[model samples]
Each structure stands twice: as structure tokens, then as C-alpha cells.
Target: METPIKIDISVIVPSYNGMPLFKTSLDSVLAQEGVIYEVLVGNDSPSDGETKNYLNQIENKDLRVFHNEKNLGLFGNLNNLIKHAKGDIVHLWSQDDIMNPNCLLETVKFHNSHPNIAYAFSRVEVINEHDEVIDKTPLSNNDTMSALTHTLTSLMAGSVPGNIANVSIRKNIFETYGYFDVNLKYSGDFEFWCRITEHLPVGIIQKYLIKLRRHTGQLSRNPKMWIYRIEENDAILETLLNRVPKNKLKYINRGLKWRVYNQYFGLYLNLLRSGDNKEAQAFLRVIKKYSNISGFYFRYVILKILSVIKRDKKFLHWLYYKQAFGNNGK
Candidate 1:
């Protein structure tokens, strides 16, 4: 058999309370074939007994470890890891996910053949807590952000949003963009992706390149359950809108379905949580500013009126029961 081709690739996996999944993550990176790669495991755990054990016995000379005394969140941890990476190609690995043995092997092959392409992403198999493949994320490998936005947003609606595990951006994009924003607890990935994708077509592998294990241990979709997502997402939206030109992002627009859905539901929760009718009315005004008035607005208004009245309001609840949810505990 002939010797496999070798190319230096830096794999950065940022860990936070990932003791149980760290070994599987590390082993997956180590299993790459026909490539020279370094596994840099950055631990952000409160105490590192378990993670430290794995790091100490990582017999591979290519595997190096960094212990972050203070736990930097995802964006901060990723920025820190990038600074320590020294390989020709770099990959951002999730500490809880498993990379396919052919992931780096395939990516390197694509990179070697297509030197002009600065970034490439692969298809990822989303697994449940038990690690069974439940879904897959398709990538838009072309170099335009507008086209990518349309492609990715469709994936989001289809249920599997693109993630860092499926992405392998080129080292040059990082050199130009600098680092991921530390200010955002969420939505930072999209900001970075939007910027890099501005110049290059994304490269993609149609095969399932990684197994994304989702469970209680991960923060996968808890943020969506938040009643204040509209408030939070609105803040990030404004930040991006200010920096990026609207015409530049032609395929995208102000009135997206996610924005509408989140705003409508978030306002409902806000009305219920409001201490008094006055605060609730103020929230309603803000909601109108974000979206156009519709029938849903009238439905919520009636619910608030009933909530505000000081006298018996059993009838109001029943009326809103039919209007708001189409059933009132029937």
C-alpha cells in the first residue's frame, strides 16, 4: 500500500463542562486519515480533573492542550484557540460532536485541488442524545452570502440549522476578519459567517462528516424556548443591520417569518408577564414598530382588556380562548 498524503491541519475544540463527551470528540479528530493534523483541546471547565486526565495521556505529538482558567464562552474560547493554532489549515470543532474519520481527509483533498476556495463546509448528521442520526444539514458551497442566507434559512425552517461542526473556513478568512465577536452570547456565529461568506463561495461535502449529539448537556435549542428571544434577537439584528448594507443583502429583508413568529409569540408572553396594563400597552406599541398590524394584534388586545378589568372577567378569557389558541381548555 502506498503512504497517505499529509497536510497540516489545526483542529480547535473548545470545551465547557464537556468531561463526558471530550474523549469521543478527541478520538474522532485523531482518527483522520491521510493528513497531518493537530488536535488542540481548550478546556474551559470549572474544574478539570476528568478533562485533564485525557489531555495528559494524549500520546500523539500533534495533540496539544490549553487550560483556560476562566471559562470563556463560545466566542471567546474560539478566538483564544485560533490564536494558538499554527497549522496551514484550521478547523473549529465542537467539544461534544464526533468528526467523521474522512472529515479532514476529504476537506484537505478538496482544499489541495481547489486552492482558490478560501472556505468549505461539509454535511453533518445530527444525532440525538443516544448518537443516532436523526437529520442532516445541507451546505451552500457557493461564495455569496445572499444566496447562502436563502439556502441556510431554508435549512433552519426545515429543522437543522447550520453549525460550526459542519464548517471549515479557510485560514485566510480569519486573517482578514480577525476574530469572532466576544460581545454576543448568541448570534455571533452568523455574524462571522456572513462576513467570510461575503467574498468566497462556501465549499461543501454532501456526506455526513460529523455526528452532532444533542442532549440536556448541550445548549442546542433552549434559547428558542426563551420568551424574550424577540427582544434579544432584535438587539442583534439592529447591530448587524447597522454595519451591513441592506442592498448588499438583497435576498434578505426586514420582515422575515422567524422575526414575525418570534415577535408575535414573544409579545404574548410579555403581555402576560407585565406587572400592569400600562407596561403591557407599552410593549404592544413596540411590537407594532417591528411589524405590520394584523388580526393577531386585535386578538391580543382583547386578552389584555380582560386582564386589566378589575371586575369579574370569566367571559373575556373564554372569548380570547377561541381567538388566541382556537381552544380555551375545552
Candidate 2:
């Protein structure tokens, strides 16, 4: 009698409005080699026959599909999928992202070699809607680091481990530390990373193991969600600030201010250009609240002035990209 392959990992893809790209995403996942794993796709779009029909036609024995009857949004679907996942380690993947062939193999190897780590992630190649590589994220050398280091790095670079597609977590850890907060629509992943790294060490796989697709339809790019994004970011930064020692608190605060400026300032401009006055004002209030942090006021003044000029908008845009991606707007 032949023995069944022991499933050590479950790649749970929470899918909704995830087609065309979902086909490519699932294909990359199904192509993963050198590991005995199962793919569990939570079809949040139960009413969408295209996604449902496509999933039904796939013949892989390792793939299992389930329907949600109704849409549960992103984190809700992820939470539901985690409950049904069978592997000790769960890789919660984005529906539009593609995994490298060795993503699962390399992730499994990292976890096996370091059993103490509750969470880990890898670098990503940023791709546009057409699957053409546009840019890659900065490399992380922190194969292992203390909780303090992880939190500090997160404050500085904003989710230092890269995309949620590359993140792998021990399923058991969810039971202990809690699951992704469905309340946060935009910054939930960043908040979750902050929450977990507070108690446990997070490791980096040091390879570009995923392709994070950037498209106009993604929720992160929506100007309508800016209010929620800033609110959640404020809460997350406050939580992290409370955890730091007094001596290091100032440095973390500085990094937090710069991160807010670098990350959302452009989005604030977008909201203004799109005539989302209410959201733009809300973002301004956030900047004003953080303005007490020494040099932050000057940053706000300079960016606000530069944002007014037609020619300087490009400089401000490049400045944001350079700081955020670290590749000089590649």
C-alpha cells in the first residue's frame, strides 16, 4: 500500500473578486515543488460563477475548495480559512499575488530549521497588472532577531518583512496570539505584524519568493479607505510606542513620524486631487497630531508647499518612492 504524503504546510488563499489573476496565482501555488503541502482556497465570492467554475475545473488532488455563501471581505475570509486549515504552518496568501516555485519549499525549510519562530516572511518582486516586474523590495538580513529589534524595524520601514503573500505563520500561534483583526481594512497586516513581533521573534527568508501584483483595483490604492487607514495606523503606532523603553522611545517616535510622512503623504495628495476633501482633512489632522515630534512640522510644511507646485509634484513623488522602496524610484 502507498502512504499518503504528510502535509506539513497549508497554503490558504482567501479569494474574492480574484479572477484572471487568481488563475495565475493558483497556478503558481500549484506549481510549488519539493514540499508535501495542501492548497486550501476559501472562495469568498460564492456567487461569482467564473471563480467557482474555474476552481471546479482544476484537477489537482492536493487542492481543496470551499464556498462562503456570502462575501466576508479579506481578513474575514482569511480568519475563516485559518479555522479550516490542517497544516501546522499556514501561509495566508493574497489572491492576486504569484509565488515563486520554491516559495513553499524555502518557507518549510526555514520553519523546520527554526522551530521557535512563530512568524516569518520573504522579499517580493513588485509586478504590475500585466505580470511585468516593476521593482523589488529591499533585502532583509534579519534571519533572526529579538522582539524589540523586530518592532523597531517595523516602525522604521513599515512592515519590514514585505507582502502578506510571503508571510508564513505557525497555525498553532494563531490560537495563542489571536487571528488577523478584521476591523482594520487597510493596515491589518501591518498591525498583525506589530502585534505578533511584540511577543515572538520573526525571521526573514532572504529571497524574493513572491510576486506582489499592484493594480488600480486593489483596496490599498483606494482613496475612499484613507480615513480607516490613518485611524488604524494611529492605533498601531500608539500600541507599539507603549511597548518601547523610554530611552529608545524617542528614536522610534522619530521613525514613526517619518514613516507616516513618507507612506501616506502621497495618498493624502491623491485624496485632495480626487476631491475627497473630508478624507484629506482627516489625514491632515493625523499629521497635525504627530506634528509635536520635533522635526515633523517642518516636513509637513515642506511637502505641503512642494505639493502645490506643478513641477515639484514629481520630486515629491520620487521622494516618497525612494524612501518607501529604497531603490531610488526604480
Candidate 3:
């Protein structure tokens, strides 16, 4: 008789219409080196028959599939998988993201070495729809407080931690701190990270261990997603305001306001360029409610003046590219 394999890690992939990309994600998980892991896929009521057929054809015994009768949102599906996971270390892998072959081995090793750290994460490489590298996010080696403060500041400044695919948490962290908030549409991972950082130190593995896919179909591209993200960010900021040290609060607040104003102004510009005058006017009203930052208002007026002269989508696209990618043009 063969000896039973002891699972050291459980990768929970919460999938909704995750076909095509989900295969790549699963293959990456299966390819991890020097670690005994199981891949648990929680299917949130995929509407297509092809997706169902694909799930049925998965032949690996280590890969388990759970079907939900109704469509559970992302976090809800994650919660379902967490309950079924048997490993001490649990990783939430997005269906669209690909993991490096050594991702599991390194994260598990880091966790074993630093037993006190609640979770560990590696740096991530951002990829486009074609699996081409677009950007890389390298996390600095900082103590718990410093890292937490920096992350909060960045969030307030309109920058998000690109993808949570590189992170692996102890199963106990969720038991102690609670699961991902289902209420949040886009910022659940951000809020969960903040919550964990409040009580425990997080380990940073500097290697690029995961590829985060960004495409037109992703939630980040949806205009409505931005509204949810901004609202959730405000709530997260308020929570962090009460938790962070008094000395850092002022600086954090300033960054938060700057980021908020910039995001609102960017949205306003996008609406104007798209010729959605009604939505643009409505967004202006929303922007006014956030802050009275003079620079943002000035930029908004200039963009509006330019729009009045001629609605040049090409110019708007170029300006957006410059702001986002700078001279490198990546």
C-alpha cells in the first residue's frame, strides 16, 4: 500500500466564469516544487455548460471542486473554501493569475522559519490578457508597524496593492481575525490585510512569485468598480485612522485626501472624454463632496476647457498613457 501524502498547503481558487484562464492557474498550482498541496476550486454557480464540463473533467485526486447552488460573490466563495481546506497554510489564488513553480515552497518555508508571523507574501508581476509582463510590485523589508503604515498611506494615495495572489496566510488568522468581508465589492482583500496587520507581523518574500492578469473582462476595468473601490477605501481609511500611531496619522490623512481627490479628478476627465456629459456633471458633484483641493479643481477646469475646444479622444488617451506609464511607455 502507498503511504498517504500529508498536505502542507491548501490553495483555494474562487472561480466565477473562470474557464480558459482557470486551467493555467490550476496547472501552475499543480507544478509547485517540494511541497505537498491541494487545490480546492469553489465554483460560484457558473452559468455556462462548458465551465461545468471542464470542472467535471479535472482528474486529479488532490484537486477538489465544490459547486454552489447560487452564485456567491468572491469573498463568500473564499469563505466556503476556507472551511473545507485541510492544510495549515492557505493561499487564495485568483483563477486568472499564474503562480511561479516555486511559489508554494518559498512561502511555506518562510512561514515555517518565521512561525510568529501571521502570513507571508511575495512580490507580484502584473501581466496583461496575453500573459505579457506589464509591471512588478516589490514589497520592501520593513517591520510590522512600518509596513502597515506604508500600505495605509499608499491606499489613501490612490494606489492599491496590485493583487493578493502572492499572499499566503495561516488558516488560524481567519479563525482569529474573521473572514473576508462579503460586503465589499472590490476592497475586501485590502480591508483583510489591514485587519491582520493590526495584530500580527507579515513576512515579505521579495521574489516575484505570481503573475496577476489584468484584462478588459476584469473587475478593475469596470467604471462601477471604481465607485465601490473609492467608497470602501474611505471606510478602510477611517478604520486605519483609529488604529495607526498618532504621530503617523496626520501624514496618512494628507496622503489619503490627495489620492481621493486625484482619483475623483481622473474619473471626471474620463467621463468628459467619453462624452457622457450627464455622468461627468454627476461626478463633479461627487468630487466636490470629497475635498476642496485647489490643484485638482484647477486641473479639472483645464481639462474641461480643452474638451470645450474639441473632444479629442486621441489626446485624452495620450495624456492618460503619460500619466500612467510615463516616458517608458510600458
Backbone clashes in each candidate structure, one number apiece? Answer: 5, 0, 0
**Against the correct fold, how does model 2 do in TM-score?**
0.84
Cα deviation of 302, candidate 2, in Å: 4.6
Give the winner by lDDT: 2
TM-score of 3: 0.82
Write down the worst ten-residue block by lDDT for model 2. Answer: 320-329
What does candidate 1's lDDT look like per residue over 1-330, in tens digits?
997544478898888777777788888888888788887778887586887777877788778888888889888988888877777678888988999888887877766666655466677788887778888666554432243342333222321235787677667668887788777676566656655554455555666778887777556454333334345456545444444444433323322322344346455556656554665555556566545556456544554565588422465334322232222224
Clashing pairs for predicted structure model 1, backbone only: 141-202, 142-201, 142-202, 143-200, 143-201
Quote each prediction's TM-score.
Answer: 0.70, 0.84, 0.82
Off by over 4 Å in 2: 1-5, 258-266, 285-287, 292-297, 301-330
- Residue 312, model 1: Cα distance from true site in angstroms: 39
Best-fitting candidate, scored by TM-score: 2
Task: Note the residue pairs that clash in candidate 3.
Answer: none
By summed lDDT, the worst window of 10 consecutive residues in model 1 runs over 320-329
List the candidate numbers ranked by TM-score, top first: 2, 3, 1
Task: Rank by lDDT, highest first.
Answer: 2, 3, 1
